[model samples]
Target: MTQRQPRRAYDEQGREIPPPTLADLRAEGDRTAFVHCDATGCGHEATISTDQFPAEMPFPDIALPLRCAACGSKEVGVMRDVVGIYARPRERTGWGMT
Candidate 1:
């Protein structure tokens, strides 16, 4: 893994918003971000909430310690995930049908 750069974060307006800090994430209220593996032949991805991170840290700093679980590579990227964070959970009935 070459430690590729992370993808740019975008907001609902398609505007590349968000400062490179944890405070910005907390202010937005949607603390979700997508973690991606940049290693060859490994495209592992996961949705993580900011709760996993302690306060008083920048967003990009997390990438340094992150690794692709599938390939065990230090090459990974973090992108602010804004789509499903605000989605309403489906209402399931007796049979668990949506």
Candidate 2:
């Protein structure tokens, strides 16, 4: 027999939200986000995975205090992928062109 995963917890709106864990992060299809150094003229975007942090540590909060590798800046900005590139239409043709 095979074992089944436990159902995720939910709030008033019935959103299935599970605790931030290493297993969960790894299972979430290469979950990635964009980050950059807050220093002026150092806007280099870096793609980091959620699994990079400690399993027990929560997101955003965990990555907030991280420093930039390129500029060695203490301030950093993180961007969550609301609409992933892979999820978008592959063939995108604008109205003006063909």
Give the whole-model CA lDDT for all candidates, comma-separated. Answer: 0.69, 0.60
RMSD of each: 7.9, 10.5
With candidate 2 superimposed using the best TM-score fit, by how many Å does residue 47's alpha carbon deviate from the native?
Answer: 0.5
For model 1, residues 1-98, the per-residue Cα lDDT tens digits are 33333444566666665446777677756577788998888899988777777666778766777878788999898777745544524442224322
- Give the top-scoring candidate (lDDT): 1
Residue 62: error of model 2 in Å? 2.8
Question: In candidate 2, residue 37 scores what lDDT?
Answer: 75
Report clash pairs, candidate 1: none
Over the full model, what C-alpha lDDT does candidate 1 score relative to the true structure?
0.69
lDDT of 1 at 6: 44
lDDT of 2: 0.60
Q: Which stretches of candidate 1 lie over 4 Å from their true place?
A: 1-18, 85-98
Model 2 vs. true fold: TM? 0.50
> What digit string (tens of lDDT, one per residue) describes model 2 on residues 7-91?
2356677665664554455455537666777799898778777656765654445456678999888778665544453564545
What are the per-model numbers of colliding residue pairs? 0, 0
